[model samples]
Target: MGHGVVLAGLCAALLIIATLAMGCGAMPIRAEDVLGALLRWIGAHPAQGDDAIVLSLRLPRVLMAALAGAGLACSGAVMQGMFRNPLVEPGLIGVSAGSALGAISVIVLGGAASVGWLGSFGVTAAAFAGGLLTTALVYMLGRRRADIATLLLAGVAINAIAMAGIGVLTYMASERQLRDLSLWTLGSLGGTDWRRLLAAAPWIVLSLAWLPLHARALNALLLGEREAGLLGYRTRPLQRRLIALTALATGAAVASCGVIGFVGLLVPHAIRLAWGPDHRLLLPASALGGAILLIGADTVARTMVAPAELPIGILTALLGGPFFLWLLLRARDGGVRA
Candidate 1:
């Protein structure tokens, strides 16, 4: 209804969805028991039976989804603000493609499952590195400083190159590696554990914390570059910093979760349409909405096709595709009105 009301609702929804999510799936633990597991988790006591399942299996996955969703949705919100385009999503800037290439490289060329935790470690680092490298390259290639279009075009070029690189890797991959690579592209939280969660958490957390600090700057940018400059905000540096932060955050998400599609793409827009566009409200609201959306998506992904988990990406894409079409049609209607 209103900003604070919306924010409070989202916070409550996230908690409920997260708790329900932990309790869903094959074992179907009760929500209260799930709460008990969480409360007992802090004591460092090794939980047995359902407690173990809740703590060891579900908790990390749910938290990962929440963090990834938060980072991605926040990034999408920032990117949309920077470009002033409702349809713009974080992946349009090459973070997902770059992260995909990095992970694919590891699965196809670098590691074997037999190598223990090091393999997962390699994939995570490589994905993050790939994202940062792509960001730098995009900034360099698209370095018109004041032209947002150049940066976006640069991202397109990088995405193509990275996709081609992924193609080559896909061709060279062993059967098992190919399967793994394909799944990575499709996205999932199946491999999530505390170790994997910890790896990407800091980047997501850093971006979540740091990105919102620039809300006022984003608000300024909404008024056009010249106007923002008149207001004492240097548009170029601000845009660059926002992109970098969003990339780091989105990159970590893509790396860890493989390539979740729509949370980043749609969540921010949902928040904006329902709650309005003040970044002070929009940013945090997007974060909570993202978490709730992903947790819900993931729960359905794992359950709807029980015993066989659907790739989370596919589920989000399926849901996002129609919503996106609605957005386009809504824009068309708005144009007629104007």
Candidate 2:
């Protein structure tokens, strides 16, 4: 309870700070103006002149970052527990690549975001389908008559294929499409709006709700497949459901915010260090931690370079890469199991 309170407080504090920071700088708006704009937005009073900067642009980006962070982090925690491997994540298992492929295909070939509702849905549908397809393929190929190692290897192969396809798509794309593709690959939470948030929130909430129910199943599966089967937990069914849910959450997140990485991987690792390997607590803690970290990263990305923003993905890699290596080294020295 104490730990939970601390985490909740941290999350709230970081969110408020990020929200305020987002409104300031770049456009160089005053704090009073930002406060006035917020008051107006809440039906207090209308701000005169252009309120687009705060109301239309930055607010949505911050909200999207929060949602994306939660989605990805929760997805990562689920994957790690399902696979019984801390190293596994959406990016590692090909979900992000698959989602990217689908979205990119829509932009490059389906006239995405330009052709009204048909085109908009086309991109999202393509992304979801691509993500599911990739997960299915990985599951099929990874199983050596239903073996997890085989599934993992197959996922690696599929990830490679999807990445190669991305390269080809990049080469063949038009100038504008290529630019959009490049930006998406780098990842960002800019340009979000209430409509976009509404479209994404349900999926995020649905995915998050699965964590508590699957906590015991993940714990059982961690004891090994044969043991889990003998222990009367249908391993395969749970695994399938986990993979499906992960694909849904991760695909939606990538589609909405591009391919933001590390939040999933990094948050789970940090939570484990704090609370140990109890998925029940790990899930929510990691979710909050991920939201706070990504919000901070996004804040840094937007502010560090002033008007020109750095990609959120770049910021995570710059920070997470070295940190991941250090984790690996410590894990090796301590001889920790997956």
Candidate 3:
């Protein structure tokens, strides 16, 4: 299929899923009601309780999920292209691990009582900082060698250290702290609101904006760094920019929604399977596919257990795990090549 056709289909699916997502939950609004509320909000109509629920509660959560998913999936596609490995993802590079450590520190060391004062933005900022710092460290370690394997190893080491730090934090946590930390690690969009969404938007948007502009560079890099440089591309600078952008995007996503996994790893690969490996098409299609998958997952999470919602992370992991195993088996069979 053509890139345009694939993109159109993904966007259509995202729109449909998002509309369904807006209507699914404990209260359960209809699709028409969801549309009516959105149109009314657009037209500045007077607010009612149901409109308030749809506009104030569900809309922000849905938008956050879509943005976070798109950003992470695009980052994953870039990482895979840069590393020249189909299996590479945002988490494999330690961004999520570092972000988790940062969040754990805030929740455990700062204490539950402090959350009222610290607010959601405080935790988000710390997580973002941690993700960027860890990714930068990994970049520094790998820059001297300029080897993909070395960079991957550095990320692995950093992720191990970050996980250790999280373990220590868990050990030291109070009951309330432990509860909050546990929930955050599991990941959910339940507590999301306009304020948290606004806080994360700029980083995600800015990072995504930088990605498509580098599509040609990413494509060139796929031909190998030396060849890309011979073609007059500044391979090293491109790598640095891509890594920084990935850190910013992934950090904002982890900060906003906690550690939702698999979208990044799974969405890009799925898009590649259907749309071919052209970075130009891959990045945008992955973004749309990610949005659709995440919104659909979030809808299932909310409705599956009714009043009690499943964590979005758990749902993604459950779905992605089997696919991951299949990839491994395919690789073993020598049928998988990226």
Candidate 4:
């Protein structure tokens, strides 16, 4: 299919899933009510109690999920393009692990005494800092060698260290802290509000805005660094900019939604399968695909157990883990490459 057709389909699916997500929570607003509530919010109609639920509770959560998923997936597509490796993702380079460690530290150290908005801000800030710092460190390490392999290795080491840190924090955590940490690590859109979404929006939006502008540069880099340089592309600056964007986007997402995985890896790969590896098409399509997947997953998570919502990370992992294994097997069979 053409890019336009694929993107349109993905956008339509995303809208359907998002609407379902808005309607399918514990209170269970009807589809028409959800649309009516949205219309009322825009001053097209009078308000009602259902409008309050949709406007106040569900809308922010749905928007956050879509934004988080789009940011992560676009970050992943950029990473894959920069490294020329299909397997690379935000978590592969320690962004999620570092963010998790930071969030866990806050939960463990800050305690129940730090309740409310201040506490939430503390965690989000720490997570963003951790993710950015880790990405920077990895970038620095890889810069010395100026090679993708070195960067990948640096990421592996950083990821290991970050995970160890998270484990230590987990051990030191009190029961409540541990419980909170577990939920954050597993990921959820359940606790989101307009405030948290606003906090995350600037970073996500800035990163998303910056990434697509480098599509041609990413495409050039795919031809190898020497060839890209030969073609007059500034390899170093492009790589640095892409890394920074990735850090910013992924950090914001991790801060907002916890350690949701595989949207990055899965979305880009699937988009590539359908549309080929053209970065321009791949990047936006991956974002849309990621949004669709996460919204659908979030819907299932909220409604599957009724009053008790599932952590979205578990659902994505359950789906993506098998897909990842299949990719690995396919690569081994010579059907794909790094």
Query: Poorest 10 consecutive residues of model 2 by lDDT?
Result: 142-151
Please report the TM-score between candidate 1 and the true structure: 0.88
What ranges in model 1 sit over 4 Å off?
44-49, 112-122, 132-160, 334-338
lDDT preference between candidates 2 and 3, better one:
3
Model 2 stretches with alpha carbons more than 4 Å out: 1-3, 28-36, 43-45, 48-51, 139-156, 226-232
What is model 4's C-alpha RMSD?
A: 2.7
Candidate 3: tens digits of C-alpha lDDT, residues 1-338: 77778888888888888998898887889999999999989999887658988998999999999999999899889888887767667676687888878767776776532555345666766777788788677656654665545666887898899889988988898786776676557888877788888888888899888899999888888888899999899987888888888888887788778788778889999888877889999999888888888888888888889888899999989988788678768766876654
Badly placed stretches (over 4 Å) of model 4 are 44-46, 110-122, 136-157, 174-176
Q: Estimate each model's TM-score.
A: 0.88, 0.87, 0.90, 0.90
- Each prediction's total of clashing residue pairs, residues at least 3 apart in sequence or on different chains, is 0, 2, 0, 0
Model 2 C-alpha lDDT versus the unseen true structure: 0.75
lDDT over C-alpha atoms for residue 200 of model 3: 84
> lDDT rank, highest first?
4, 3, 1, 2
The weakest ten consecutive residues by lDDT in model 4 span: 140-149
RMSD after Cα superposition, model 3: 2.7
Candidate 4 local lDDT, 16-50, one digit each (tens): 88888898877888888898889888986778878
Model 1, span 1-338: residue lDDT tens: 67778778888889999999999999899999998888878876666569989988999999999999999899889877876667667566677789888878877887543365676567767777787787666645544453545655776788899889999998998887776776667889887889878878988899999998989988987877788999999888888788678877877788778878767769888777777789999999999988888888889999999998989999888888898678767767773111
